[model samples]
Target: MKILIIEDEEGLRESIAEYFTEAGNICETAASYSMALTKVELYRYDCILLDITLPGGGDGISILKKLKENNYTDGVLIISAKNSLDDRLQGLDLGADDYLVKPFHLSELKARVSAIIRRKMYNGSNLLLFNELSIDLQAKTVKVHDTSVKFTRKEFDLLIYFIANKGKVVSKNAIAEHLWGDGIDIADNFDFIYSHIKNIRKKLVEAGGNDYIEAAYGMGYKFTGK
Candidate 1:
């Protein structure tokens, strides 16, 4: 799962990001409202950790308003030092799924995130199965007909992207944006996209899995599952 931590406290932000990353989740941080806004607008996260008090011009509530206005229905968890009933109620009214009082244990936060993701993405299920392939999201492992399949960081990311957008034609530009973000500007072309896809396909098939990726000519690639 991809997560965005929008907190002003540097130490707390790093601690949260590191904890989540060590648990096999992709995590990013933003110390100010503006930086958090930029990340929220550009990418889709499974969950967002927002802090009510910010260093910049805007607060987390305003950020939540913008996200809702843009139709971002993903799970949002507000982490704040304020323990007032009105504050919690206000955050909930603004569409936040969960609220956590500050100085909480990291384990509790992780549990909340897991619960939110399972509810939103899997209807409370932890396993994702597609044909002969199964992904144990909680365990951070993939298997093909009970046989384990190992994947590198990029390869795992690419596979997850494909599974998430299965049966749809995903363009190379979209893939580049999701995987490398703005870093793609350094590349002259999308040759790296093709290379990664080729390698991923080869590995999956070599693991006794069926090929599901289809070339879309001048467009890009599609995971048809047929």
Candidate 2:
């Protein structure tokens, strides 16, 4: 999963980022509102952890409004010390999917973030199925025609990204960002992405799966599942 932590507290932000990264996720952090705004404008994320308080001039709610203006469709989980019912409700009203109060357990935070992503991408269903292909989100397992098929971590993440956006043409830049976050320089990464896709196709074919990934001519690739 790709997540952005928009928080001002250095310790808490690092804690959250480290926890997620250790779990094999791509996480980016911003400690000030200006930094957070720049991130939101430039990249996409599976979920965002937004803090209402910030040392920078702006607040988290303004960030939420910008997301709205940009038609950014993803999960937003508010993580703030402001635990009043009104604050919670306001966050939800502005389209946050979930809320987590500060001083939270890391385990609980992970659970809530998982729930929010599932809700956004999988309609809250943990098991994803398309024809004979099945993916168990909790287990990180993929099955083809009822038999288990193993995938490398990168391959599995790529598969889910394709399925999540299914028919849409996914650009190479988007693929790079999804798999690598903003940590890597993907400007000249066509060869890298091509290799991964080639391997993914090979593995699926060896597992008796259909040729589902379709090239979009000059565009990118699409998951036609055909």
Name model 2 segments beyond 4 Å from true. Answer: 186-188
Question: Each candidate: what lDDT?
Answer: 0.85, 0.90
lDDT of 1 at 12: 96
Clash totals, every prediction: 0, 0
Write model 1 residue lDDT over 87-195, tens digit each, in one string: 9999999999899998999999999999998888777888888898888777767888888988777677788788878888999887877676545678798888888
By TM-score, the best candidate is 2
Q: Can you write out model 2's per-residue Cα lDDT over 1-226, one digit (the tens) per residue? A: 9999999998999999999999989999999999999999999999999999987889999999999988999789999999999999988999999999988999999999999988888888889888889899988999888778888888899999998889999998789888998766746557777888888888788888887899898889999853
